[model samples]
Structures are given as C-alpha cells and as structure tokens.
Target chain A: MMCENQPGALIKMDLGSLTQTAHDPIHLLPCEIQYDGHAAVDKYFTPTICQGVSAKEVSFRGRPLKGQEIKIPAGYIGLVVEENHRPCSEEEGRTVCMKSTFLSFTQWNLETLPSADDCAMMSLMWPKISEAIHRPVDSEE
Target chain B: MELEKFERNNWGSCRLSSLVPPLCRNQHCCLGIDEAGRGPVLGPMVYGICFCPLSNKQDLEELKVADSKTLSEAERERLFEKLDSLKEYLGWALQILSPNVISTSMQQRVKYNLNALSHDTAIALIQYALDSGVQLREVFVDTVGPAEKYQEKLKQRFPELEITVKPKADSLFPIVSAASICAKVARDRAVKSWKFLEDLGDVNLDYGSGYPNDPKTKEWLARNLDPVFGYPQFVRFSWSTAQTIVDSRAVPVRWDDCDGDEKSSSKGSQSMLSFFARKKDDTKHQPHRFFQERKLETVKDL
Candidate 1:
C-alpha cells in the first residue's frame, strides 16, 4: 500500500519503466524502499522524485509496473537482510543471533570523499599516529 | 728393607740440612715502599712504607695483600687496619701540593717537580721506618723516576741504607702493595675533604676527576676563560689547558712591551742582526746558506 503523502513509509516493489516529470516544483517527499531483484531499473521521472533517492529508475513516490524488476543504484542508502547482528563472530553465542553484516549506503556526496592517495597515505602513516598525538609529561625527577 | 732403600734414594735425604729453612745469614731487613695519587689531577701525592720481620712471611700472605687498585676501598681499609696492628713497624708520608704550585711548577719543569716531590715523600717514609728500629739493609721502592737516579737521590738522603728502586715493585712485592693501599686510602680521604670547598664556586672548577676527557672539566674551562677563579692552589697550573686559557686572554702588545726593550739592547741580538745582513748580501746563495756553510767547512776539514 502506498500513501500519496505520508511522513514515513516503506515501499517494496520491482521498479521498472517508471516515468514522471514536473517543473517548477517547490517541495519533495522522501521514502525508504526495498528492491526484489538485481536487474537495472531505468526511467525519466520528476526531479522531485529523483532529488533524494539515489536509484536510477525507482523514484520517491512512483511504483513499478508489471513485468519489471527493481534495481538499487550505486551509492544508495538502504537496509539489507542478514542472519546475524552481533559486532563480532566471537559473540555469536548470545541470544538474538548477535552478529550483523553491513553494506554501506551508496549515496555519498562525491565532493566530500577524500582522494584515494590521501586515504592510502593516512593508512601508511597510522603506526606512528600515537607518537605524533601523545604529548610528553612535563614533570620528571 | 725396601722402605730404607727408598728413603736413601730420596733427594730430601740427600740434603736434609737444606730441608730445614735456611737460617738468616746476612740479617737483612726489607722495606716495601709505594706512593699514590701521582696521576690524579686534583689531590695530594702520598707515600707509605710497611716493614715486617722475614720470619712473619706467613702472616703477610694470610693478610691477602695485593695492589691497592685491585682492592675496593673497604677491603683496603680492612687490610690497612690489620697490617697496622700486625706489623711491628709502619710509616706514612704525604706531600700536599696546592694547585698553584702544581700549575706553576709544571710550566718550568713539566711535572719533574711533582715527581721529585713524590720521591721525596717516599724516601721520607722509608727513613721514618728505619728510625723506628726497622733495619734498612734492603729498601724496595715503587719506581717513579730513573731507577739509578732515584737510587742516587735516596742515597744522598740516607747514605747508610741500601735502596732497590724497581718499577712495578708494588705488584711484584706484597709488602709494596700493602703500602700502596695505605697511601691510596690516605689520598682518598684528602680528596673527600676537598669536597667541602665545592660551594665556593663551580663544583667542577677543579679538573673533572683529574682525568683527561672529563666533559665537566672541559666545559668549565670553556666557560671560564680566565684561569684565576675557582682553581684551587692544589692544581698544576702549567697544564696545557691552563696555558691555552692564558694564551687566549694574552694581550700581544703587552707581552711585546715587556720584552721589546730587553731584546733590542742585548749583544746577542746585535750579532744575530749582523749575521742575517751578511747572509742576505750573498743573494745567489741557497736559502739554507748557514747550514750549507757548516756542512762544507766540516767536509773540507775532513
């Protein structure tokens, strides 16, 4: 079931061939959704529907038609099903399947990402990081 | 019968009289003498002598006597006390030369005066031992100077005594090592007393442990360009470090003014000036004209 305008709602469908367009739109409603398959979804939709949603075909409000599957775009943000939710494998003995796997959301703002070289250099110099950060004590006998 | 035959063949039986400890024939007395603190830059030089009867050889060995440097201060002190109580005669002499005397004397004679002073102290200790009823037929001194010269000097001081000045006599003779301990301990005590005067100025104003390459001493010298302050009279001022300090501060014009007039009026100066003038007149001659002339004259006469 889909509400035209609800504050928080979940959308689950195979999104394909969805097209919507609008100009001079002032506001947009965002939604969280799940896709059922791995096929690529493509469409031309209203800028409002594509503004916050990172998927290429499935828009914020429109639903996919028959004979189509949904595909999540790269850098999108959503949840995936996992058997365990614990922080580490050593803690699996506890209740509620204490391990969980995480798939990072693909919706990163490209401008804010550090360069690959910067990331590599930071990891290379990590061993001496403590020495650079620690201050010597002033009082010594 | 076999036991009698074996006994007759034994070398011990062949000279049974020699088996008995040889009796003292010459009635000679041996005195072991040693001095300490010669190399130390900061303290007094001390000489000590110890004498014991030849019959008490076992007693000296049982005391475990050795060179003083080989023993810790505590062991030396213990041995010193035991030797003092056990030996019938002992004597000590200390020559305390102030830094000023050591410094000035070193300039003129290059530590000759210091060696002489140490020898004088050693000779005095031997004399004292002899005075206390110890026979002086044999005197073994740890050599400080030429053995013959030192013996000659000692002879001049005590003509009646026979002196044997041997290098490293302390390590060779246990008696000399015992005397070494006494002298070393006495000098160490004197150095400890000097600690009281440290607060008057830089504690390192005196040379660093009197050993070369002491950073504190070098640092002190570098900081104090003038040699006057904090250097006690006990130090040898003639040391090259002192001379370097003096040279660094020397006013060249002042030295010239002091000696310039004397140099101009001397007859020897007039003769040297005339000789150089005549040598310059022979322009074609080699620069070593004086040396060549002496060689040629010797060759011609030959």
Candidate 2:
C-alpha cells in the first residue's frame, strides 16, 4: 500500500517471508500469490538445482533451459510474473547482489509447522527489534 | 521621597520609584522617561521609558541611580542588568535624523520634535504596560526643553495619566537617571551600528563621543566632505560647525576671489590662535594707557 512521505506509489514485499511458507512439501502443489500491482514473468530456479545440468539437458515448452544461476538458496522457488503483458525497461546503473546458501534440508511436514500463536509472537517481536535499530539517539544535554 | 537629607551634598540620593507621587503611594505603576544624544554632533536621539512597582522603591534607591554621565560605564552596565532582571518594564524609541534634517530645522524646533517624540514614546510604553495588565497612574520625564512645553505635549498624548517634567530631573530624581541610562545605552548601540563612514577611507570615528571638541571627530568630518558624502546621516548638521566643514570643502574656484569672505568663513577654525590674539590686544591697551597716565601725572608734579 501507499503512505504519506513515501517516494513513489509502489509497495515493496519481502521475498523471505514467502520462501519460508513455500518450503513445506505438503503445503500445496503451487500456491497463487495475488497482489494489486504488476509482477515479473521470468521463472527463476536456484543454482544448486541447475549445478550438473548442461544447456539443452532440460527443456520446457519446446525451449531449452538456459541454466541461468539463481542467487537464492536451494529448494526456494521464487519468480516474478506480471498480470499484464506490458514490457518494462531493464534496471540500469550499479546494483548490489545478495547470495544465500542452504546447508541442509529438513523433512517438510505440515504437522510440524509453527502454531499461529508462535507465528504472531515472531511477527510482533521482529518489528520491536527493527524499531530499536532505527530509533534516533537522544543528544540533548 | 525626602529632599532634606540630599541638600547638604552635591550628589543626592532618593528612591527612584517613589519620586512620582502616585507611585510612592503604590496606587499604580510609575514610568520614568528620558533621552540621550540630543546635543551630540553625531548619532541618533534615543528615548527610553522604564516602569517599576512602588514596592521595589528601596531596591532602586540602593543602586544609587544617577545620570549616565555621572556613573561609570561598568556601573551603568551592572545596574542596567539588575534593573532589567527586576520586576520592572522597559521600552525604547529611536529617531535617526539625517544631516539634512538638522541643517534645515531650527535648534528650538529640533528640541521640540525630540521632546514631543520622547513624550509619545513614554505614552506608548505606558499603554503597553497597561495592556499587559500593569496598573499605571503616572509618568515622569526629564524635560529636554521648557517644562511647560513637555508637560503640554505629554498631556495631549496621555490625558488619563499624570505627567511630571523637571529640569535636570535625571540628577534630582533617580528614576529619570535609570531612564537616562537606558536611552544612552540604546542610542550608543544604534550609533555603533551605523555605516556613516564606510565609504570614507582611513578615518575611524566612534559615535562621535556626542561631544564637539573631540579631535578624531573633527578629523572624520574633514575627511568625509563631499556633496555625495554630505553630513553623516547620524550627525546634527544644524550645528554651525557642520556647515563650516561643508563650506571649507567647497570648490576653491567658487570663493577664490573673495579673501575677506574666506577669512570670515574660516572663523572659529583655530581655538589657540583666537585665544592668543585676545590676550595680546587686552595687554596692549590697558597696560600702556595706565603707564602713560602715570608718566603725565609725574611730569605735571615736576
């Protein structure tokens, strides 16, 4: 959503929260993420999944997999799909890249998922920590 | 309140707040008004009014308030702070007369304007104090011109409150002196801020000391002598010396043929030369006449 003093009328969503919910195997086959605004269409797969695969080894819809690297950890599926078929210009200038590595994968079980109370407590405590980090220092004598 | 004790000494003491009859009785707040830089050859004339409650009469008396000239600058500054901090009120009004105004207005007329301005400023301050919840009954001013004239002016402006005017009131009354200090300090600050001599090179003048005999002041005048520079905006150009300086710097071609006019115009230029001339003329006639008369009397006796 938009708020006063925000530079542009765009909403920023965190990919980390979506990745945690998608890690469960019994969660659902493919969940649809519906939002108000546009999204990217390119599907991205983690580098670990494409490690030993060569170009033309995997193909989908008569097109060979490009074996492109994904910056996120393995088993985390992330992609941007636009609701409209509008073309967008590529982002220009300097950019910072982030990398995440998965050490191991635990068995996904829906019964072992966090309770609603635990999830609520984590959400509430996370903001308090973030607020404490962003608060200004009092310099008055 | 009593003048008996102070009569024996040249410098007297009195309660400043109690001088005004209404204030002494604690009926209402009293405001004393006075001005500075009226007779100065330079600087703007500043008028100031100070108000205080009758209860603090003793505190004001303890400070020994006197005319600004009588007190040292440090002492004036100290009392200034104390008066400012005390339960009192103060207001200031300033009028900067250019050399042109001074050159045009008669001396008496200038005094009238200054007195009228001071009375107006006092009334304004009194009204301000009243509006701020102060109950004021009277205002006292050290008269700059005739007491009757200032009294008339004050009455016209503030018909509701009582007004008192007296000669040398700053010396006779303590409150007037406090007002004098306030006016003087304010006027001095104004003069300091002015850029009268900014365009004139090399000559440094400080408020002209408000005195005519200052040498540095005379030098400043001599240096800034052009139609464009004119008389300094702060100076009282009505004074004869201002005109004389301006005339002295006039183009030589204009009065070059008239030596007599030049000499007369240069009158009062050298204080020492005039003094010696007067001394020589006095001794030449009186001493010789007495000696000749004595010699004739002796010859007649023989």
Candidate 3:
C-alpha cells in the first residue's frame, strides 16, 4: 500500500497558533471503541471531573474513569486531523484537513490513574532519545 | 415518576420524596430509615425513610408492614402500594445511590468505603425530612455497623430526636419495616428497568438478585465481562466479587498509587551501578528500569 503514489491538496502548510483560543480539551481513553465514526461526544459523554487526592475522578457512561493531565513533551505539539470523505480507490490517499492543535491531552484510565510507567507515557521519551543518539560525536572526548 | 429523572442522570445520586404529610408536620412523628440492595454487586443502593404521626402507629401496623427480608417480592410490592395509598397520614423519601456513584466514591484515592456511603445516605434522607418541616420526634434506623456507635453518631447529629439504631430493627419496629418495604420496592423497580447507556446491542436482563453469590448473577457477570473496559456501568466495580472477576478475566491494569509487590521488588533490586553503566563498548548494556517498566527501548533498526 505504501508503494502506490497518491496526491491530495494541502489546505494549509501550517495552522499557525491554533491553540491561542480556548477549546474543548482532547482526551485519550484507555478502552477501544469498535466503531470508527463521528460521535456527539460533547452532548453524550459530558465529563464532570472532580479533584481527588492524587488524581482526577470522572465518569463515562456510568462507569468510573480516572484521569491525569499529560502534558506534551517540550518542543512537541499535537495535531488533530479530520477526513470527511473516504478514498474511493486504494491508490487514492484520503484527504486530511487540520482541525485543531493542542499542547497536552488528558490520559484516562478505567478506575485508576495512569503513571509514567504506562506504555503510552513512556513512548513520549523517544524524541529526546533519538536526538541524543544521532548527535555528532566529539573527537576530543 | 422521579425514577425517570434518575435514569436520565444515572451516574449520580437522586432523591425522591413525597409531600410532607400535614399530620406529620402538625404533630410529633416517628421516622424510620432502612436501606436495600446493599449487598448486591449490581444496581443502586437505596435508602428510604417513612414517617407518620405517633398517633397513627396502629394504622401503620394495620398495613401489615413486616421485615422486608422475610417478605417475597410480591408482598413487598403490595405493602409499598398500601403504604402509598395512605399518603395523607404518612410521608416517605428515598435516596438512590447509583452504582456508578457508589463505585467511584468507594474507589476514590482516599478510599470512601461502602459503609460510610450508606451512613451518609441515611443521614441525608433524615436531614431532608427535618428540612421539609416534618416534626420528627423519634427516629429508628436499621444499623449497618455496630449499633451503639451508629446510634451515637445519629444522636450527635440530631440530639433533639429520640434515635434508635439496632440490628434487625425492621422486624422489631413497624415503622422501620415500612421503610424497608419502600426501599426494597424502589430498588426492585430500578434494577428491573435499568437502561444501559452504552450501545451494548441485544443484551439480556437476566442477572438474578444482583447478589455476589447468586449463580445467575455470577453467570451474567462472566458473560458480560469486557476484556478492555471490564463490565458495563451496571456493576458495582468496587465490590470484591466484581474486582475478583476483573482481576482474573480482564487485562491487568497498574495504578500509580498502588504499592504492588511487583513494583516494589523491581525498584528495590536496582543497583546504583546500573544507573552509570552507559559505555560505548558495552553493546549488551541494559536500559534503565523507567524504560523497562514501560517496555520502551532503543530500536536499533527501523
């Protein structure tokens, strides 16, 4: 699938400073939802978060969901993209449009607060590690 | 009915009450408090209060109010209906603690246990009566914990009222029995008509009794277990019965505050030298535990 070449218009090269205005915060839920479709998340899943001793508490569809704010690593940003139409052919890549940008998102877990030891949190360390590995080696060391 | 409002916001607690009977407001009244669905692994726990003028004690007894535990579902329903008919002589209220609220409160970081939740609900119901101008002179409660301590607590909260907290107060006092019937009937209807907010298509409602030991409830819990999300919100997730099922059947989840033995052992065994062993010649050097715990590693190749 990667060998096939397909092209689509880029609406904008950079959505500069989209995070200037306050907007709905994005969440990374722990569970897998089977459907891949747009949902009325604001209307349906309105989260009422409360402060706990060490974490935040919320409920999703009557189930307890614990969460913690996960800030994006320094020098990193998150982008949300949307595609209204599906590609008609395998060779035609789907057109993607920039929706919003965020510097951080809440990581939610089922009944427990996620820690740095979680896989998703750990993966965020890759960029710094990669840069350190590829840096030029000093000859005078 | 107020139950509709509760169903709409099923994640929170809801209170339902009848208008304060004029007789109760005019004369000194006796109030009884009881709860239902306390032991169930599914559905809500309901705290109910029934109050009537002390002069109408015989009328309450005439309604054949007895221990709700000894009565069948049909008998409880009949008694509740009979109690409802005498609205002019009696006033009642219920506080329905939803399963979601119960689970979340119990599982909070500071850990609010079920007994505390029950006591708070009962206290709230009693306070609601007093606020609504019910001239309650006496209060009887079916205790969940040590009777003397619970009675002392209630007395401390409402010193003006003569409070009686005893085990099996439902069987001993007709007013408490009436409260038990209201609680049991409300709990039964709530559990029976519970609507799943999730889109679990074509799921059946055959979970029997909601008790942890009931075979039918056990079967339903096992059958409906979601490997990723655990059971749906219908379950009381804080219950050991439910937690046992999740721990054994669902994916293992680790929390930050949990001092699990596995986490302690991994941290305890690490040596100070392992932190400084970053040498160019050592191709076999092990990564730090921070990476190992999260299963992160340097990919040598794409």
Top lDDT prediction, candidate number = 3
Pairs of colliding residues, candidate 3: none
Each candidate's lDDT (Cα)? Answer: 0.47, 0.48, 0.80
The per-residue C-alpha lDDT of model 3 at residue B286 equals 83
Sort by lDDT, best first: 3, 2, 1
lDDT of 2 by residue, B1-302 (tens): 12222222101111112222233234456667777777777755655666666565466777888888788778777777666555433332223333323333333211435445455555565565566555667677788778998788778877887888888888866777887887676556555555432234444554257666777777776765544223433456556566577545633222112356678877848676566564555444343443343332221110
- Runs in model 1 deviating more than 4 A are A1-141, B1-29, B87-95, B104-112, B195-208, B220-230, B249-302
Candidate 3 residue-pair clash tally: 0
Q: How is the predicted docking of candidate 1 categorized under the CAPRI scheme?
A: incorrect
Instruction: Go through the candidates in order and give the clash count of each.
Output: 22, 2, 0
Reference-based lDDT, residue B248, model 3: 86
Per-residue error for A26 in candidate 1, Å, reads 99
Task: Give the C-alpha miss distance for residue A21 in model 2, angstroms.
Answer: 82
The candidate, 1 or 3, that scores higher on lDDT is 3
For every prediction, compared with the true complex, DockQ reads: 0.00, 0.00, 0.12
Cα RMSD for predicted model 1? 39.9
- Off-target runs (Cα >4 Å) in candidate 2 are A1-141, B1-27, B87-133, B206-208, B251-302
- Considering the two chains of model 2, state its CAPRI-style docking category: incorrect
What is the per-residue lDDT of model 1 for residues A1-141, given as tens digits with 9 covering 90 to 100?
232344233233222211221112111112112222321111122211222123322111111111111222334322332232333543223222212222221221111222223322233333354455575856872
lDDT (Cα, tens digit) per residue for candidate 1, span B187-280:
6655555532212344444456654357766665555442222233334345655445544652211211235568767855576557656565
lDDT of each residue in A15-94, candidate 2, tens digit only: 45434342211111011222233211122111111222232121111111222221223333333322222225322112
